[model samples]
Target: MKWKKGLTGMLLAAFLCGAPGVGIATPAHASAGEYKFDFGGGTVETGYTGVSASLSYDSARGYGFRTPENMRNVSASVRFLATGTKSENTFDVDLPPGLYEVSVTLGDTSRSSIAAEGVYQVINMTGNGAKDRFQIPVTDGQLNLLVTEGKEGAVFTLSALEIRQLSSNPVTNRTIYIGGDSTVCNYYPLDSSVQAGWGQLLPEFVNTNTFQIRNMASGGQIARGFHQDGQLEAIVQYIKPGDYFILQLGINDTNPKHNESEAEFKDWMRDMIRQVKAKGATVILSTPQGRATDFNANNVHNAENRWYRSAILALAQEEQTPLVDLNVLSSAYFTSIGKNATLALYMNGDTLHPNYGGARELARLVAQDLKRQGLSGF
Candidate 1:
């Protein structure tokens, strides 16, 4: 079956916390996601099954895949597999997509001298080691644990393999939903890179297969206009329990056509935040970034933008939700960089829209804020 677009690769990933299982849920030890085997036989948790390309499964002989070849990492008692080298053959565990942590115990419980090569897995592991835990991003696919000693043939012991669905709630991984104006729109192969929005660069920072960035932001959308156009409703449709909503609507709302009084803007944002939280999602509020100095100096749009920032700050304070404060960050960035350097990020000398350079910088700042906010799945 087709899973959600962002739910790709391995179902889950793990962050390296000293104690392990920091952000994700921890099941009751080995039982939640563990597998054991034997040469004379083996056993598995209720949800696990071993797969191999070499042999047919038989119930009497344990009805499953065997660890191939002279890579002796298996035993009949509390059997575990140590592996090295990327080989054509491997034993696989079939798993449905979600967040998961794989814990491999390296050696006998009494000994610790298990090491070689192959654990550095990018495409695959071509080494061996005793124990390591990884947050795997799995799709609707098989998790292949390779047990080999490569051509060099090193010896390693494997005992007690444990796998756990990190998130007991099963909704730990999430998507980042962005809602805003052109500033946050995913600018494509446009007239130029300068005609870019920060959203376009956002995906570059995230592992799309794990943390998907849905840039639902458009070229021109205010809170009221977005609602009237059904954009907000459409956004709400796919938002599940584990998701994020970054709302930045002030740029257009601060304009004449979509102008909202400070009080009105605050009211609208408050309602929007309330709606999002009601759906079991986290909502982050961002203020509109600054336009070029010349533009801010001459255009009525600047005053409107300022009003929006005020309202946004008030709303953030009132709700106690996280705030990106893009206005402050962008303003500081421009000030630090100075005019000529900053202008390079502006489009066609227009102070209003940022070019690709600016967008990327904006995205970097946004990503940093997300990390600090702990919205990032660690």
Candidate 2:
């Protein structure tokens, strides 16, 4: 194993807790500034509009809101010097599900302030009002920031505020590292709309708060191909000890025109497994889902090319890695659904890759095996 280092080197945390919907209350305040809140239930950057605070930074200012053309200033970097003493002050921030470094700097350079995210679910910021920073995990993306105003309605001078994704693992929550090919890539989706990769659907079955499903898989990538594309390196960079790494790549490798002999394929998998294991992460290897098979034996992916899947299974045993036999389970599933139904689950009968339904089935099989093995984060 070359033990690909520096693979990790990107931002990496937290939970999803709250009612079915976040209750955003922008109560009446006597402040002269403006504010924008985004409760991210969907793509739109909109939320409740309460009494305005007019302190929005002017774009002409160099270090202010990097608001995209017509979008709201969700990425604003302004100082709120007057968020009054309302008994309860709460607002939801629309942040993407990922690890972030959140900070709140008070006005005075030598004073104390208690700034927090996740409604006291996370840690508190304590320091000289310069810049108090902390790592925060955002599971559902609609992050809640709670502030309890003083009895006299004092001025809470927020000299600075920062929220950005981390470039390293804070090790806040469990992570499922998905490593695979097109069948598992988080693609943009096709015309009919349901045909997406299985990895994209995996999140639905698992709990986002408990586990972060990091899809590092891509299209046209085998074990060797993934490494060549910097994916393997990226995986190594963030996969901490106790995290789970799912390896599912074989369909692309099985192509006759593709590079690598059977032994080379096996060796590549072995090395990847070894490397992942060294990082203190548990590994799960999955065989690719079976392509569309005609009962009359006329499919291009005939019996001869089936070795790629078996190689994955055999290597799993060789590496003592858990196996999610999608080939067997997916084949049985599509068969139960029948040829027409199976074709419907693909992109207009593109047997090679699965459509949305097919991807869901593949995800179900993996989820079953993962939960079966008692994986921690599912």
Candidate 3:
């Protein structure tokens, strides 16, 4: 079989910890400004393979994964002995700032093939002060290696593979502001359990070195109320050129307390778009997530729910703003998983507020949408 080299600068160490009979030394350390973390050493039984490894930073907020900027540098190396059979393997790394390189050598005259190796550079050009963000994307910088058996009983081994970080200046930085209901607000100790919002998970997907996410969503506030109460104005004032605004509403909007009509709702959405665009910032309209109730085939509740959603869609198209169809996507996902399976994500049986898991799922979907639209980079 053919043996090739594959490596990434952002390789994770978490999975490597559990690789079969693998031993890892305390990660080698670099000076404070430039940190180095490493993972290596394991045995593979013939056809049996080793686990993929990675290293991540603890954001101290319960989010275990590290953002690109938070990741100073990463490297992965492994040595495995094959007993009888051959295996194909791939390694993954989380992308971070700096220049990266990889080298692979075959064991026992096996003549391993070097499938791939390279360097990736992430530069932040925005003037935002957040350094824990990375502008370089890791998606394109992946190395694939192929290993094959020289002879029927040939044992293939891999030696120390390394990655390094290069120094560069902090470039550009942008900000993302979130506005919505309590479901998207940050919670302190006072209202902990009841207030988990998807906005909290938004940071994970964001490359903090290039962009910062500021959540301004509050509880029990509708679209109209948010503007009337000056929350909208506050958000607008903080928005700088090249910033982005994510607006998610409709939960509290439908509440009798807000009592806004279809026309009023459309107008409000249009005005919000205009104001955001006026600031030279981009606006992304998110449809509210679906409620837990599963209307029957003939139920008209689904049709009634469409009113607000339709208005949002209409306004988005009219204003030429980007749209994230959270309503449709979440509903389809929940339906496919069934109520019982999906309930675990909701907060305290409340269809309105999402639990941490739900919030994370929502954030992932939103990020996916952003990437698809090429808006996440903003």
Candidate 4:
């Protein structure tokens, strides 16, 4: 996905939060002019307005296809709108100037690249029961969305589109950006997935109205390699003043394959810290939690393979940044729960990663630490 600047300084992005579950339901506090479109000229899903491909843009309707002739309705049993040509996939909706949570349901079989307001909203999301919901700022009084093919031979398909205004706007809202490894990244099929990261569940514990949680952490990431691979660049583009950057890494840095020395790890972290700080964003350094299998025979959880913890602590003091000692917090929790029960927290008894329950508990600890440190978001 690419980022583009709107006249209102709104940042364009389609950060995936979760996949399709029970379909779109009406918000309890629905805003005026909220929209729900069930595309493809078939039986409209409950609570959704039916939209056919032949329906062109009409002033009375307030929303429609820009080029109706180029679109096709392939729905027979289930509603589906498909377009093989990129130029023909344009759709528009008239929305008041504000931030809106756009929920789009894509077809299960084919992949698609969705862009709104000249910025990619959903990028290359394809799978069974695929869906994406993200907040986007609308400044031009209209939400212009384009759905194009994701890859070769993949026609763009749309099942539904729902738009609801949000109280949070891009200009005023502060975001909590998280950067780290698999232990802090989001996993797919959130409802069913056993694996999860603390970053993924952090949103549940924080105030979303004040801060948006953008978890950029991914699996198999290290201190130096994460920046080298251009992951930080994505965060750097959107991070601005009043935003908080929470960094928790070092788990993968110890791997011999990464070859990241202690000094090099600190150097890379310092680089990331300075970069975000330069953007007027506050940096919060955190020690990655200890592994589930890091306990000794005496039933005590030891901070093994966490050599970078000391460096992180030192840098937190040296840089005068807030620190969340997840290593200490998580270790104490595991020890309190006993060895057998602690092992149950991890998926398949894996030491390095945590299951959903474990991730939620870890996230709770992180949230508590943030509150203890008096961080603004908490």
Leading candidate by TM-score: 4
**TM-score ranking, best first:** 4, 2, 3, 1
lDDT of 1 by residue, 146-201 (tens): 43331233443443334566653334346777878878775433223446778768
lDDT of 3 by residue, 275-366 (tens): 98998889999888776565456431232364388888887888898898888777767767776767778877586678877887888888
Residue-wise C-alpha lDDT for candidate 2, range 130-149, written one tens digit per residue = 33344556566434443322
Candidate 4 — what's its lDDT?
0.70
Predictions in order: lDDT? 0.54, 0.54, 0.52, 0.70
Error of 2 at 106 (Å): 33
What C-alpha lDDT does candidate 2 achieve relative to the native structure?
A: 0.54
Alpha carbon lDDT at 368, candidate 2: 83
Count clashing residue pairs per candidate: 26, 20, 23, 0
Q: Please report the TM-score between candidate 2 and the true structure.
A: 0.56
Ranking by lDDT: 4, 1, 2, 3
Runs in model 3 deviating more than 4 A are 1-172, 189-194, 295-307
Candidate 3 TM-score over all chains jointly:
0.52
Q: Model 4 TM-score?
A: 0.70
Worst 10 contiguous positions by lDDT, candidate 4: 1-10
Q: Tell me the deviation in Å of residue 228 in model 2.
A: 2.4
